[model samples]
Target: MYVYRSHDQQLLNERVAQFRDQTRRYLDGQLSDDEFLPLRLQNGLYIQRYAPMLRVSVPYGMLSSTQLRALARVARQWDKGYCHVSTRQNIQYNWPALEDVPDILAALADVEMHAIQTSGNCIRNVTTDEFAGINGKEIEDPRPWCEIIRQWATFNPEFAYLPRKFKIAVNAVPDEDPALIGVHDIGVQVLQRDGETGFRVLAGGGLGRTPMTGEVIGEFVPWPDLLAYLEAILRVYNKYGNRDNKYKARIKILVKALGAEKFRALTEAEFAELKDGPMTLTAEEVDAMRSHFSAPAYDAIDDQPPALQDALASDKAFNRWYHTNVTRHRQAGYAAVTLTLKKTGRAPGDITDEELEAVADLADQFSFGEARTTHQQNMVLGDVRQDQLFTLWQRLDALGFATPNLKLLTDLVACPGGDFCSLANAKSLPIAEEIQRHFEDMDYLHDLGPIDVNISGCMNACGHHHIGHIGILGVDKKGREYYQITLGGRGDKTSRIGEKLGPSFDTEQVVPIIARLIDLYVEQRQPGEQFIDTYERLGIDPFKERAYATDH
Candidate 1:
């Protein structure tokens, strides 16, 4: 984790003071509700259905143990003793008093974190792959690039008041775990080819009312021209993206109307003049930024730890957890361990204060004092020694943080639906719970294999329902809660939007429909095929027919 400079610290301190005073004025009736809306939103405060929600940014989903401890303390003291991790890899406290939020921000600032730009239509959190530097297949760590973009976008004068919120994701690997080259307003994939590194830029992709995968505007934008190219894209969007209807205001709509060819032309025209201008990213500056994210030093150790093998042989639960939650690291003797948020009957992504504290302690003990939050709504210890895997699993299990389900049906990605969000038309948590209940057997899930089931409360696609292998979007049909199922959607390198499967199902019917869909897949799938692969091999028709079959 990088520490802030004295100037940056002072700026944040002053901003906190400013927000504290603004909060006081609002509480004292000096500022009207309407008047304070944008101000509060800019500070990452949202008035939810029950109480005020405060979203805290975890830059690129990276957090220090100290920051985790602070977050736990804030949750315990200022709000409910629980926090929700969101799809953008930020954490949200569902109940915080308006006055207490400034204190929370101050606490975050102390740890080089803040809620600034977590909301309010400006460039939001710059998310990258959680396994950035550690993944064996990664070409380069995208975190440094993400950090560069974060700094460039934060409080940017020209882009702060755009027609709609903008999102950008970057991936350094060819596999695209962050799905960075997919449905973002601007998707960037860092690639190394022919002895040079640069970005493959995609423009005008988003998932909301209209879902479109970004089109590749620049196949190979040299590393030196990244910022200038990004500036050109933003400038083009700022000038032409619709502002008349909020629904049509996103850059995706503009791209759709203009068509990808014309949009590419427009961006190229803008890029021509700005290629080597003031904002150009020089090699020296890129190298300087890269130095900040150099891989952590590790002591040489045996690749296979004898103690871990003994523990795995002796303990069934630990073995299951180790097998499911742990991943291979590029470092020979290290592992990246996922701390799953999905416990039976608990809300997906909800972590209690005690669990947070325990995770913080574990991060210090096992992961070199740093942890990561995945866009899949789980936490990760990216640098655990292979020998310590069993010990970590035991501790996590004791703290209720270890769930032996990763990429299973139970490990769902969901948005806070009608229960908390005003935009949601139906409750997402209940649907997640219902599905979890339906698929409790580990054998059944393991057989199903690497299924991504995402549910969104509504069409905003906050939970990334459009990209799930089996996507569920909550819809309201005449005030009744109904869920629309989409199959064959994937968010990986070969990304595709899900196709709808006939009529929507009522709340009770949703789970059974999902089961039927899975059953169809299992029956039709060739040996050893994952759900997404199977879906690709044989299209949505087979699953759709079986899911809606009248054999019951």
Candidate 2:
């Protein structure tokens, strides 16, 4: 994890002081609601369906034990006793009083954290794969570049506000893309061409009412010109993106309006002019960024310890969790473990302050006092020793963090819908819980194989329903909650929007309909086939017929 420098600490302090004054002025009636709206939004404060919700940024999803302890304290002290981890790798406190947000911000700054650019129509948090540094197949740690972009884009005068919100992601893994870069406003895949690290840049990918996979704009951009190239793309969008209608204001809309070829041409033209500008990244600058994320010392040992194998043989639950939750690490004798937050009944990603502190303690003991958050609403300890897997699993089980359901059907990704957001037409969390409960059997889930079930409250696509293998979107029909289902969606290297499965189903019908779809998949799938592969091979006809059966 990168420790904050003096300058970073100073910036956060100043931002807290500024926002504190802004809040006081608004409370004093010195500022109108309209004037205070954007100000509060920039600091990640939002008036939700209930009280104010504050989003605290976890830059690139990396956290130190001290930072996690600070967050746990804030959760207990200022807001409710829990916080929700968002899909964008941020944290949200759903029940903060309006007057205390500035105080929360001040507390966050005390630990070298803040909520800047977490919301509003500006560039949001720059995200990457949670397993960046530890993934065995990753070409390089992408966080250095993410940090570079974070510095460049944070409060950049030119992009404080755009046509709509913008998102950027980076993926360094050659064989896979765990970061979902395909759905970002700007996506970069790091590459090494002839001994020089560079980037393959894409633009105009996003989700919402209009979902799009980003188009590759630059096949290879030298690292020196990476910043300038990004500036060029943003400049194009800032100048040409739709500002007339909020619905059509995203860069995805602009990319569609102008074909990918034309958009690339425009960006290239802009890049030619700025390629040699002051923003061009130098070798020294890149090294400095890399220095912040240096590797930890490791003992020389075999990849897997003999004790781990013996433990796996003795315990079924530990074996299941080890197979599903543990991922191979870059160093021998070390593993990265994904602690699932998708347990049934509890809101996905919501953790109590006690749970948070316990996880922080686990990180301190097992993962070098550092942890990372995933886009799938999970926590990861990126450096647990292979020999200590059983002990760590025991601790996680005690903390209610050991679900053993990574990439399983019941591990659903969902947003705080009508229960929390005023913009939601139907509640999504309950629907997620219903589906999760219906498939709570671990044997049944593992037998069903890898699947993604994403649920969104509305078209804002906060849940990223478009990318799930089984996508459910909440809708309002005759003032009642309903859901629209989609199939065959994915968010990896090959990403695409899901196809709808006909008319919407009422709240009561959603679970059975999903069961019907899964049953159909189980019946018709080829040997060793997953749900998504079967859907893609046979198309949506079989599932559609079963899902829409009126006979119940």
Candidate 3:
């Protein structure tokens, strides 16, 4: 993790002091709720449905063991004994007292983390692939660029009060880990053309009441011009993006109304003005930032660990974990171990303090003292020695973090809906729980295979239902919870928005309808084909027909 300089440290410390005072005033009734709203939001405190929820930013989702320990301590002392990892790769505490939030922010700043830009209509945490630097397929590490953007956008004067919340994601690999880049406020993918590396910039992609994929404005922005290009886009959005109706305020709406070509022209004109400004990223500066993210040192070991092989041979549980939770690493003897949070009946992405401590210990012992939070709301201990796999698994299992259901139907990503969020239309956690109980059979899940069953309490797409292999979106029909299903959506190399499968189903009928849809896929799929592949091969007609069938 990058350490802050004395000047930067002073700035943050002073900001903490400011927030501490503000919080006191708010509690003392010196500040009205309306007056304190923006201040509280700026400090990452939200007055939720039941209590205040504080979202802590884990910038680019990178955390040191010390930082992880700090997080554990905060969770234990100030809030609940557990934290929910968000879809944006940040952490949220659901039950924090409004007054204690400043203390929490102070603790976070001690570890060089803060809640700035984690909420409100500004650039929320700039997310990237969890496998960023360590991925074998990366063109170049995108973290440096991400950090550059983080600094530039942090309290950026002009963009702080945009029409709506903005989000950005970058992936250096050909395969997109965090899907629907086309649907973000700004989606950047690092690409190489000939011998030069740069970005393919997409703007105005978003999902909510109205969902649209982003359009590519700049196909290949050279590495040195990253900030300049980004500023240009932000400028255009700030100057002309919608502000009349809150619902139509996202850049996605502007891009749609203006068309991609017109938007591109506006951004290009802005770019020409500030191509060599102070915000422009230079190779030297980029290199300096890159040094902070250099790969950890590793000891040479055999690619196939005999101990792992022996465990796989003897233990069916270990074999199942190896097949599902483990991913190939760039290093010969290393693997990326995904610690699934979707343990049967537990809430997805919820990690207890004890589990956090255990993960920190495992990272120190076998994962080069580092761990990553995936966009799918899971954790990855990258750089794990293959020989240490069994030992790590045992420790994680004891901590209740060993769920061998990665990419499976039961490994669903759901938002903290009516339970915590004030904006949610329905309870999403129960829906997820219902689905998990409905499909507890490992054999059935394995047979179904690699299905992304993403659910959101509403169309805000916080759970990214827009790109799920099977997207389930909650709708409120006359104050009753209903679900609308979509099919054939994918978030990988071939990204596409899902097509809706007709009428919405009542809450009671949703899970059974999903089961029927899966059964139809099973019946029609070619041997060994996954749900997504089968959907692509056969299209939506078969699944739609079965899903709406009266018998089902």
- TM-score of each model, in listed order: 0.97, 0.99, 0.97
* lDDT (Cα atoms) of all candidates against the true structure: 0.86, 0.91, 0.85
The residue-by-residue lDDT of candidate 1 on 162-187, one tens digit each, is 88889999888786546445888998
Error of 1 at 537 (Å): 2.4
- The C-alpha RMSD of each candidate to the native structure, in angstroms, is 1.6, 1.0, 1.5
lDDT of 2 by residue, 1-552 (tens): 667889899988899889999999999999999999888998999999889999999999999988899999999998789999899999999999999888889889998889999999999999999999888789999999999999999888999879999999999999677898888999999999998999999888998998989989999999999999999999999999999999999998999899999999999999999989898888898899999898887778787789899999999999999999999999999999999998788888888898889888998899999999888898999999999999999988987788899999988899999999998988999999998889998899999999999999999989999999999999988899999999988986567899999999889989999999999999999998999999999999988889877787
Evaluate model 2: give its lDDT.
0.91
- Reference-based lDDT, residue 403, model 2: 86
By TM-score: ranked, best first:
2, 3, 1
Residue runs of model 1 more than 4 Å from their true location after superposition: 28-30
**Pairs of colliding residues, candidate 1:** none
| Deviation (Å) of 104 in candidate 3 | 0.5
Q: Which clashing pairs does model 2 show?
A: none
Off by over 4 Å in 2: none
How does model 3 fare in lDDT? 0.85
